[model samples]
Target: MIVPIPPGERTYRAQQAFEFAGSDLAGLVLFDDQLIQYFTGFIFIPTERPIALIITREGERILFVPRLEYEHALETAQVEEVRSYPEFPGEQHPLLFLSEHLQQLGLRRGLIGVDHDGYPPVMGYSGPALSELFAIRRVSAALDRQMALKSEPELSLIRESARWAGHAHRLLQQYTRPGLSESEVEARATREATQAMQAEMGPGFRSHNRWISGAVALYRGQIGPNSALPHAISINAVFKAGDNLVTGASAGVWGYLSELERTMFVGEPTPQQRHYFRHMLELQDLALEHMRPGRACADVDRVVRAYYEREGLLPYWRHHVGHSLGQRIHESPFLDIGEQAVLEPGMVFSIEPGLYVPGLGGFRHSDTVLITSRGAELLTHYPRELEALIIPA
Candidate 1:
């Protein structure tokens, strides 16, 4: 069962949606089959087949679902009108039914904003075809751009999620040992996260997949030139006494998520591990120190790259400094050279700097951060300092 969003929250989301469409007279039509999996809330389930449609205009909202699910939609979703299609004859298909319904509602013309990219084509009416029939112009990139900025309520949800994820990480650290398999450590982390969410927000706020826990225990193995390469799943190897365990956990509450990653040494670390760990931490601090309003994301990247180049560790450092996080784990406003998006208040992103040495393993530290007027505020408060867990050999 999904929890109902407060009326005020719906109104806030609707306002943002209107701004995103770039018109005061815009409507958002989300087909039932759309993969709004990233959207936080229980009103809509993740579906590969379109079975629902949501239409929103200035001061008006409507939702259309199959007759059987009409009651559920009304109870869970926020909309002015909840309608079903069983009443219509000759058209069992939802798209055709919706088109006819829109015509009846006098919405057959003007600018209609359909989430073509967000919805599944098989279940919903194609934006172009609908435009041809209704003489409506489809708005592109408007909705996505609007969703990038986080509102107060949205930020609150994200902060809560991050808090739970931090607790999970602490539990994981306590349970980790030299002999523990990567899978075992990951399982414990997932359990910790699940318990945290249930304790804080209730069972309604649970993840659909194990991957949502986003807890990965990467044991020391071979490192490569590309630091991001170790971030891949296959690189998670066995644990040893002197190995560095790079682990992170991500938890989603309502539809918002916070991701955290850190490097932990098992027992005592070798000189090489200690050296690279300090270097990665330094790089992370540098990225954080450079973050501020009006600063180009690309400039932050350049500073990080310059530091690595000066230390002759450029090859090990690959990928961007970090990226935006919210409803989606990876959103827009990426921190890289090609990105020209200026830093703005209320914007949240991650700052992860890593060093990978081939045949030796990897070292990385990641935290979700929010860009404020004065500086960046770190959301994930787990320890990232160079420390060794004294596991009995």
Candidate 2:
């Protein structure tokens, strides 16, 4: 269900959106309760309900929620008006109600901006309805352009989230050893993430269960080369000595998340594993160095490709450099060819350079970074240092 946001938070977000759009106000429609819940940092609870929002140019906001959720939305939302629709047989559909409300606000025409991508078609009535009632023109790029830059508060949330992820990684490092099942390590990591969030951010934060695993072999019943990918599911693979372990630790603080992963050797890494890990780290650094203001995103890809080709590692560069990150795990400003958007300050993205050698598993180092006027700010702080996680052969 859509819980109402505090008026202060609503004002802050609305004002930020207005500034980002370079306009008086941008109308945002939070049609899905789940989206609203996550973006608003509300707890995820299942509900067969829909919600709508109208943020005005002057910072006044309104919410349209189902009758059952009216009180909850009122309490949780930051908007001034918390209107409700009865269970059934209402005078008008929710869309029409919203249209009327917007019309009443005297926003039926003239430079009203919206985020078509954020407000999917399924979430609200088609543009035709809105267009019929108001002079609506699609300002498709408005929200994404605004969201590209992270404000201080947004960066604070991301930094805190990264801290929790670091804590989770530490827990994984301590618990993982030879003879332990992949599921066991995953369980411990999940527990650590959950506990860390609860303690750090209180009840509003929750960690999703996820982990990763892989290996070489064991000798003398000790931990072996371990290679663990951050797996969100159970893995039956057994850990052994000399195996390489790669794991990603991710934790959500409020609705924000920070992810960091490392490659560790159960005992000592083989020459091949160490080489691959080093290359992956280098690629990560290369991607970060190439990120700058006004550089074409496609140019970023060219630099990565050139580096990989120079090292005779082109075939291993499976994915693009990175993608934008925000309320959604992956958003726009993709680091690839054909993306024309110039790099701007306040944009945040992941520069995850990866290499997947067939039959050898995959090696990827990902970090969420904010593009600043100076350069990129790395959000994840966990050490990427390659080390041997000795388990005593």
Candidate 3:
């Protein structure tokens, strides 16, 4: 079952951001879906129809949506005022109404912080840019930084997300076997796990087909020698005995997610494969050991990379050790060699160190780790030991 945030907290985030700014910003407008969800806990179908949230300095707030979506907003949005317009491109630009309201509310020419990277794109309609409507500032980065610190409620969701994602990984292991089609195995396992989560999540759960509140059962499941490639899915690949499997699983609840990954062998693994897997697991542990509050994100990656080089495994290292996670799948403050963001409490990341040898499959273990006051906490806790990952013949 799902628990909705109290109306008070729904608006607290936006107000807190404004309070943090302590500047000349007059109001905040949220048009991007991620921002909309983060600010209001409201989810909507993203059609060509444009929707927006506006907050004025005096604390006047409004949600502008298509007339058709008016009732949906009324039922779902925690907004005190919901102002919707007529059909799209009929005879008016939607921004016209927004502009007129801000003017009527005495906010014309006021500095409005928009929750978008740049200009808000009007999909399937023609409209003047928001800058043409009012003085604007990009506050997306500030919001990103603020949201990186997970609140207690957000942490609860992340924990649940990990549980669901870990369950999916277990299902993936159960459905996999020699002679099974990789596609068929993944499809069945994903369906089964998603259905189970839906059934357990209950009537209180609000689910949308989109990412919000959507739990993935199987995101990436590759088998055989082709699994050696990290990113590409092999075409017409078949699972076979003695083949190595590079698998990935995700559990997302309310847009927050945790990733779980493992390198599995369909049968008893060869000695050479075991050797590589052992080193890969150790590398991942080294990265985890370096995780703590106040450490630089880049420094951690540098240490892990140097270990790989010292071990003569630098050529097999592919991507960064990890990256921050949030409403979007992959957010900023990445754990790359050059990233300068400092680790902090409430920040979450993936501790995935991989060594891919072509024709031998990728050897990697991944878990979403949350930075805490003490140290790193693993969210996705599925078996990573080589023996635990073996699928008996």
Candidate 4:
């Protein structure tokens, strides 16, 4: 049976990060929304207003937010103090309040480790850098390294996420038809799968996104020739009988996520389509065979690119093999040509090697994988063969 993340997970993260920051620093200040959630388990919408989490070397945790989030922070933030300012760009700016609070916490004369120099300049709000107000050192890479490696509890959530994503993908296939618009099909399938998830997971389960309460599976406009563009935006185009479609599905289990994507067809595929689909599967197989513990991330990309080049399909290669995923959809240690990070046990990756033929369609499959001591463990259980993915015209 799958278990939810332990209640003390956030506290453990905070303690580990503080230990990594060392005693020389006054504290560690996190301005990134994902980092705050990683360290505190307090999920909040990121907007023009900035929120911060401060962890002192003494293990004291403090959270600062706007007055609008004061009650929410008090109830949700895992911190000793939940301080709030009136608003953003108020007479006393939020940063000023943060500075004063830091001083009150005895952080006047020492260096503080920060994820970024200041609150990210998002949504037209700009202000003085944290360096302008206090002494700071950038330690974002250290945090990234810590978050890249997953523990047993984190993997449990991701495993659960993959299970729901597979269920949603099955619904997406069952709901697809030649005459319906992509949005109509997606809406019907997502609603039914979400209802099923709610029934099965019980009331204690909650999605990471405030708007989406359960699993999501979508085509994202990857229909017919539009699928040739790897990142095609959804235009809600209608499905056609002979259309080659690409689809994606994912679900958030308390901020942990898993990716599952596939290339499928609305009806029987042509001979050329079958050839490309088989080649795409072979390329992905080559990459997966090379993915093992202690292997460099770049090696996987290199192997896949070599196969594409040998088959004269390099022009169709649009992106890298895949990327790591967890609290965010995309994370570090990417399977790219230049990444030097070695594959280690506990690192989870989305193994996707895609080929997009212009004016034809895209053929690709993505699955979540975990690096184990012996080899890689596949997490997403969706069928990959073309025969299994075909839909009736």
TM-score of each: 0.82, 0.78, 0.91, 0.96
RMSD for all candidates, in order, please: 4.4, 6.2, 2.5, 1.6
For candidate 1, report its TM-score. 0.82
Better of 2 and 4 by TM-score: 4
Q: Write one digit per residue (lDDT tens) for candidate 4, span 230-335.
A: 9999999999888999999988777788999999998999999999999999988898898899999999999999999999999999999999988778888899
Q: Candidate 4: where is the Cα deviation over 4 Å?
A: 1-4, 19-23, 210-213
Number of the predicted model whose lDDT against the real structure is largest: 4
Model 1, span 1-393: residue lDDT tens? 234235676556665666656564545565422122323232455333345445556545666666766787767665577777663222455566677777776666555667553335443333224554554444434555556667777677667767777777777777776566666766776776676567665545554332354323333332222233555654444556776566666675665677788777667777887888889999999999999989999999999999999999987877889988877777778899898888888888989978887766678888999988899999888767665333434
lDDT, candidate 2, 280-373, per-residue tens: 8888888899889888888888888788899999766677888886555666789987778778887888888777665455576678888888
Candidates' C-alpha lDDT? 0.65, 0.62, 0.78, 0.88
Best by TM-score: 4
Model 3: which residue pairs collide?
Answer: 213-254
Model 1 residue 307 lDDT?
Answer: 95
Give lDDT for model 4.
0.88
Pick the winner on lDDT between candidates 2 and 4: 4
lDDT of 3 by residue, 225-317 (tens): 676777865464667788888887776676577777889998899999999998998899899999999999999999999989899998888
Candidates in descending lDDT order: 4, 3, 1, 2
Candidate 4, after superposition: displacement of residue 19 in Å? 4.8
